[model samples]
Target: MHGTSPPESQRNLSRGLILLLATACGAMVANLYYAQTLIDTIGPEIGLSPGVAGAITTLTQLGYGAGLALFVPLGDLFENKRLALLSTAGAILGCLGIAASNGPVSFLAASLITGICATGAQVVLPLASHLAVKERQGRVIGTIMSGLLFGIMLARPVASFLADAISWRAVFLLSAGLMAAIGIALWFVCPTRKPETKLGYGAILGSVWGQLRRHRALRLRAFYQAMLFAAFNLFWTAAPLELLRNFDFTQQQVAWFALAGAGGALAAPLAGSLADRGLMWWTSFGALLMLTLSFIGADVAVAATSVAAFVIAAILIDTGVQLNQITGQKIIFALSSDARARVNAAYMTVMFVVGASGSLIGSATFEHGGWTLSALTGAAIGGIALVIFLLFDRGASDPD
Candidate 1:
């Protein structure tokens, strides 16, 4: 799979190609999250109840879930790069719809569109894996994955700042422009990689069910990711409210707190390198344990007024979350080189949907039981994730 010492020029070109692909994927994904930073302003602007405001995130998650089931599998039958390009074009239109919206209903409709189209990132990940040399696969994939993590984590703060200075709708306008640019870049830059299988659309959809039955690793990885993402989502979903009520925090301040999680994004490359070094299982196990411990710090942060505790917990939780994500992807990419995109689509679709539900549940729990309830619930979920990891034999199947 690896070319032994390809010409330096070829290696350099591969690196450049990976970077461009990452950048395009990042920009497209940022569209799905733009509404998150603007949810508060959008709710009041559109006269939505607080609970309904939470639906903004929920709706996007549901749309992504639908896309994962409906669109991601097309990577196996359709041209992968073309799918990415078309998805980006669709995302641009979705962002425009959001920017033009005059009410919550319109915004909700647009949000769903954005989520459906934003699965471009899922398609692109497999494209990256396919492009990588075998020996450098994990590190190369990790480098690109880091770029993606940056967009997902930082888009909120960046969008929030933009919305503060401009209108919330302006955030969507900027995203629309970025998506247009990405679609064009992808058309020029992405390598043409077609599917090897001749599975018809009906056969492709049926394959997912067959894959589920045959691939226990896929199921375990998805469930593990689901629980871990739920923990991560629960914190981000509920922490802002806790800060606003107890610490008297402002939205900008809370947005800035996200920077603490950027440290976690930086951990992706490191985790990927570890996976390349043949420590994938250990890295995953250790990261899961660390995430479980972070829940303790998370509980402590609940009532504490000290900035130190909150910051520390944020770093631990975010780092653990990002580590789990990178490690899980490394595992899946190794597990199914033949159908990497569908594998990722399975894991991410379930995990993200879990994340979306965790966010909604976090809010409802906070409303009823306050920060304590939210923190404990998150910690409990993390603990359960660790248990599942422990029960599964990491060596049950050989890495592809």
Candidate 2:
């Protein structure tokens, strides 16, 4: 798996390598989330009113979407290890810049750059797929996804606690260091995967839209995950607000409540295994149902002001979201063997760009109507996805 390695250079992809790749994916994707839970604390310090703080979250997601379209497809045309390192380098700079930001514009710009460069996770995942044997594709993707999901889950709690213990700026500063280490590790350990595609950069970019339009499964899965991810973002963005406002929870308490969602990371490996066993549809159905139920339960918890119930809802919602995401990734990654990165870019761009709106939507809804309204919006999103799954998914093992 070097500069001159063939397509089969790492067909039997080792566990240690998988763990390293998984760690890299998790650490990079975690940048998209550290801002989410800290919106309350970050907004004021950077001179943004509460009304506009969520903009940072949206900007970060938008950055990721921009990267998916603008950079991730390069994984197919360039050496994956070097490309990921380049993206990582950019993310490191973004993190460092955020740690030093003094105004709203500077902070927002840094957030966007961090989000965009965070697509190093995107490159790394496809790189893992390049090495994975056919039978192990789902499992490898799932294992890596577990790390990404855990990173998503862990980031909020970690940020909350870090902000509580030291300062919000420390989170990004620490992350900058982590990204540098991971980038170096990737450069040294990961085998170089030069995509076999002969397509030029412009040609690959052009093929992205066609990839989305051409693949039925890709479209369906993108839509499904988009809805669920919106719910996921809305919950994380709004839940802390409710905690601080209604329950008078301290930042440490909020961290503990947020930590509940970390349990959801377990769903990734399990969902991947189920998809490998041809139960993707059932797994997706269950995931959607769980999400709807979790939202319903969260509404109840918010109304009752019960932290325990809120914790349960957090775990369930996060699990449901991860389950559907892993299933969708397994499906889409199988859609185009030759165009994995482009198809992945298309699938993720649709998901994150649309899903990013959840922050704004949730913030406004919660401000006017409270968590009850927020929960209703999330439930409605989850319910719609469930209906679409029922109508279109049937009992099929895989998409056509």
lDDT of 1 by residue, 1-400 (tens): 1221233334333666777777776776777677787877889888788888978977887787888888988887778878998888889888998888878888889889898988888888877777666666777777777778778878888888999998888888888898787777778866667767776898787776666577787787778778888887788878888888888989888888886666677777887788777776777778787887877777776666766678788787777776777777777777666677677777777787776678777899889998888888887888887887777756732345
Mark the 10 consecutive residues where model 2 has the least summed lDDT: 1-10
lDDT of 1: 0.77
RMSD of each: 3.2, 2.6
- Number of colliding residue pairs in model 1: 0
Task: Candidate 1: list runs displaced more than 4 Å.
Answer: 1-13, 44-54, 103-105, 394-400
Worst 10 residues of 1 by lDDT: 1-10
lDDT of 2 by residue, 76-194 (tens): 78888888889889999999989999999999999999989989899889878778876777888989999988887788789878877899999999999998898888878788877
Candidate 2, residue 386: Cα displacement in angstroms equals 1.1
